[model samples]
Target: MTTVEPPSWQSLRAAEARLINTGVPGVSVGNAVFESIVTGLRESLLRLAAPQQAQALGVPPVVSRGLLERVGYIDGFPNLVGTVYSFTGSGADWNRLQEARAATDAAWYQEQQISEVALLPATCHHIYPLFEGVDLPGPAVLTAEAHCYRHEGTHELGRLRSFRMREFVRIAAPDDCIRWRDDWMEQQRAWLTSLGLETSVEPASDPFFGSAARLMKATQREQELKFELRVPVGDGLVQAVASCNYHKEHFGEPFGIRVAGEPAHSACAAFGLERIVLALIAAHGDIPADWPQHVRSVLSLDDAGVA
Candidate 1:
């Protein structure tokens, strides 16, 4: 039997280079065609969510540090969080900073003050806090898109330090939440198939930090709390392009979200926008104009005039 090897990081990188500009390690600047596909996908997601009556939200890239703390994000993934900092020093301090920079001092950045906000780690992080101390009259569904950041040690194509996530969240009774998530799982699978991408759904876990996180990951998978939609990117490698997560009462209890006097169960269907674009490029090649008719139409690139 001939076994095909999965795509290596170098192969993925080369493929990405042909479709987008990577000016920084682990970060990318999408070319016009790339951005067009992303925008079209986001619009399609919004249209699909419209029937659910979800309140569309455009969340800021930065979220409050306190909010993350309340939700135990710092405790769980402190290493992955990106804290914002700014120079808040006087003229003398600025002079010292300049001198330190000129001297190539390693600790020069220590002079800056940490800001109240940090780069948003996930799109759903900001949604929970909005329902704090309030009882939802019934189920609440929200759809949002945000630029998310993480401090990943390794940089690879589709696994970026900064990316965009489109999330459809539901805060409701446990049964309702789980049902909504499962339904979306099927819907997302169908949507990916419609784009002519080979895809699979499998149980998965978050990359939690620390030794204790092993137990958390095991528990998460054991409980089937998360499942990912994986697509072949290159070689034989498969990348997770989207995820469906059932938080149960995780966010509700922490943020004081209540539905009918009890902690509400929350679930989210999240789409990694950039990863989808990369998956498309991997499957269809760098030329958007040469992609299948259905794919181009779905992405609204049929008349985009891209060469």
Candidate 2:
């Protein structure tokens, strides 16, 4: 067997410093990094969208509990939702909430429902439902960035309880949907190539909710249905730099994202902007001169003018 080497000292140092700086639970360099990635990602995605397609929209930071419930998220994966609740009274309740959380208090909190709201789980969840019951002249594309929240157990450096996600979504007839998914992957591959990253296209499947998740992954190789572009980040960590997903009719059915008159098909390509930035920083170090000249030049320019 080939011996595995450790992550590069330079890259590890940078990852540590950056990760520590950004990983604050509610605040940290994580926010700043997220902001920077979102800014660059939006510019890049908008460049690839159809000219007359629907303009980009910013989804609400938080999706309502009811909306998520309607979509069956609560039943499918309650563990991943950050539910909003309140203490029963005014001062006493406020004090109770402010105290450091202990492991043993699950039911006590449920007694208080000042309002039932949930932090948004996925950025695209807010945007996809906007097409419900609307008749459109033709296909539309939407690009959006949102700070998404998840209640999970992982406390890693790059992963966050809250992080920004940028997605380019298309809703239209079946043919248009398939073309959008296939074409965007090609465009994204070209773009990544220009950035000097080696990439591969591999089929992937959704992390379907419930027990079906495992079966779906095994039977249909659902994880392979969607293709991901990954770049090695030294060590053994290969960041999922970008992804082109074919949701087919899964989201369209629930959201009623119909075509001109028929039931629509929907698809989206999501770039883990922060992950991509991390990969770039790790592989190329922090110097601008190290990046491909074209990519570096684009990074130098503002949205208003090329540098």
Could you say which candidate leads in TM-score? 1
TM-score versus the correct structure, for each prediction: 0.89, 0.77
Task: Name the TM-score of candidate 1.
Answer: 0.89
Model 2, position 26: C-alpha lDDT score: 32
Tens digit per residue, CA lDDT, model 2, 1-307: 0111233233332312133333245323432332443456567666656563656786877877888888767766677788877765788665665463454554556557745678888777887678887766788777877777777565443455666677888888877877778888898888777666677777765455676667766643543447887776444567566788766676778877667788877778887666666666665654434456666544543432322
Clashes of each: 1, 10
lDDT (0 to 1) per candidate: 0.82, 0.64
Error at 289, model 1, angstroms: 1.2
lDDT of 1 by residue, 169-271 (tens): 9999999999999999999999998878899999999888997799989999999999999997654568999999999889999878899887899999999
Candidate 2 collision pairs = 22-29, 22-30, 203-224, 204-223, 204-224, 204-225, 204-226, 205-222, 205-223, 205-224
Off by over 4 Å in 2: 1-38, 50-52, 88-114, 219-225, 301-307
Query: What's the lDDT for candidate 2?
Result: 0.64
10 residues in a row with least lDDT, candidate 2: 1-10
